[model samples]
Target: MAGGKLTARSAATTKPGTHGDGAGLYLVVSPSGGRKWVYRFTWQGKIRMMGLGSADVVSLAEARGLRDEARRLLASGSNPIEARREQERAEAGKPTFGAMADAFIDNKGAEWRNAKHRAQWTMTLREYCGAIRSRPVDEIDTEAVLSVLQPLWLEKPETASRLRGRIEAVLDAARARGHIPRNEANPARWRGHLDKLLPKRQKLTRGHHAAMPYAEVPGFVASLRERDALAAMALEFCILTATRTGEVLGARWSEIDMAGKVWTVPAERTKPGRPHRIPLAGRAMSILEKLAEGKTAEFVFPGQRAGKPLSNMAMEMVLRRMKIEGVTVHGFRSAFRDWAGNETRFPREVAEAALSHVIGDKAEQAYRRGDALEKRRALMDAWASYCEPPASNVIKMRKSGGGSAV
Candidate 1:
């Protein structure tokens, strides 16, 4: 009776409409009259049951095969229930590339100086690393990284190289944290690996410096002068004084001395961390005077909103409207240096001092203590004259030892 096959009618008669097969393996009849095959077994000293199949779908022989397989696994010291659970857990533990990248950025982005730099780092990763975004971080290999970087490598080498380094860092972090198995060789590294494959980036073409020629400056200034009631005046003032964009934009009324004709930028705002004394030229003073007229605010160029200086973009936008391309507002300092070197006879020290540039040798800076304000005053006057429309008659000027025009 244990081994014999019984017809459904005979089993039903013997069981009297009760719902289970006689053996440990059973066909349970539900209220709806559907029969399902289930097996009860012991694995690792614990009782367990595995559903073999629906009796309607699986033949008796097929259900026996499934039951035998489950029993064999249990007999071999494997807990079938636990094994299935672990398989599911392993699948869930695998992290997507996007998830890993976000983790990497969150951990590393705080080291950057500002929000702009942090934003750039994340944006590049999101844009170029899209292919592997959903792929498991543990499974990402050189080929996977290559698929993301290869297309942009030649066309945008700098961006591609940056993307590669960031991707490598993310994977390396994952590896260290046991999220992945090992430190996979970064496909993006240029020195030993990628450099062998791609053409080297030009060293000279690395950074952006937007400077304009000195010869074209007079015409540019003339064009700027024709524009009215714009931040072009402040930008032009910045050029005449040989100061920075931030210095001009954030300039307060308190810093300017109308009697002394000097603008002293505080040490905090200056790049060199030393207070800079700019000898205000006649043209620069004139512009400041115009801005001060009818303006009751503390800032010379106040923002449309109260208590704030002018927006940083205001001056740059003014330059763009003037149709002057390839020249940054900050690069005007370079233009001034070129003019001082080529057109005028001002000493290198005086010109450099005018730009608030830190000079060589700390000993020299300690020894040369004089600010040379009067001398700078005359030099600034000459610069202002040059910026103005040239008269038909030329005037010869002599240079003084203190860097003033005689």
Candidate 2:
């Protein structure tokens, strides 16, 4: 076989036959009238063959160019097929963590139960794990991972912990697919390295709820009541329903069923990635009704821009305006949970369900779907009554065992 250029026009003129060019290259003409370029070569002292492509697809000039390149690789003691694969891998190595993360998110975002979860995954990777986002996955190391977490390890331990774990998971996935090496110790694992460096987080304090006292809740609610606007209404609704900030901010009017007197938060909005039914208490309904009165926007709390939800910081600003310090908007859910557990007679499961929290064993949570909206309604109604101005007859219980009824 000899190597040379073969044009479509020349290929058409050739008779139906197989002929060699010089080296190991050949032009094969089929009976049905198809033309192709084939390369016959010796690799590792063994006969090898490869197709350059069709004369139409790979021009005669392109085929010769590939053959020349393959010959050069062969001279360098490399198998042409393996060399070609290596070249392909080198081209693919350009994808950075940020790029791969985007691709992964695009394919997997739909599988997430809610928009918040999807957003959190991307946001944390982009904002917190800055080193890994754009750097190649294979290049990520313990030091690189520590750069992202070390600064916040003590101050924002929980967030830092989650960011570390997520980064480890991303890298582990890349490693599993042979994009990187395996058995890399997770830089985020606290049990060994991080724990040795940082102060130990107390076990008793691990799950301690950071919430404002109930005694201060009325003052906070009263302060919020003075504000009049969609943001205010949304915040009030959040407080009444004991929902998260994202849930309240992202809520749409369509989710509220006025006829059914219920607000059904879809799985995408709920924290547990499941749908939650909230029985609209009289107060919560009133808040919604007032906001819906002559309102044309689709969002429960419409922003200044058309078709957009209210800013995420709207409720946080409300808390700040009330001069409440050291309390996050999210901590309000904790406050509600505290009130429900200590101040009300509602069952633990009912309170947990009202918060859209997954409780008990994983199997138990998997089996439980309903949010016990009716029971929650009663609890919310009582909560609303407590938050409202105290009635004249409502008595204050004494420190002693017995006290006069209201």
Best by TM-score: 2
lDDT of each: 0.69, 0.68
TM-scores for the candidates: 0.47, 0.51
* Tens-digit lDDT track of model 1 for 1-406: 2243545554343332334443446666666666677778664235677676777788666666666666666555455554554455457997667788888878887887866566656655654564566567777877787787765564345766777788878887777878776545655566788677666667324443366666556666776776784487887888799787667877889999999899998765665656789998888888988888756467787655334456656777776676666667767777778788888887888888888887879898899888777877777888877777544343322211111111
Candidate 2 lDDT trough over 10 residues, lowest sum: 397-406
Model 1 lDDT-worst window of ten: 397-406
lDDT of 2 by residue, 22-59 (tens): 46777788988898887788853478887888876887
Give the residue spans of candidate 1 off by over 4 A: 1-208, 390-406
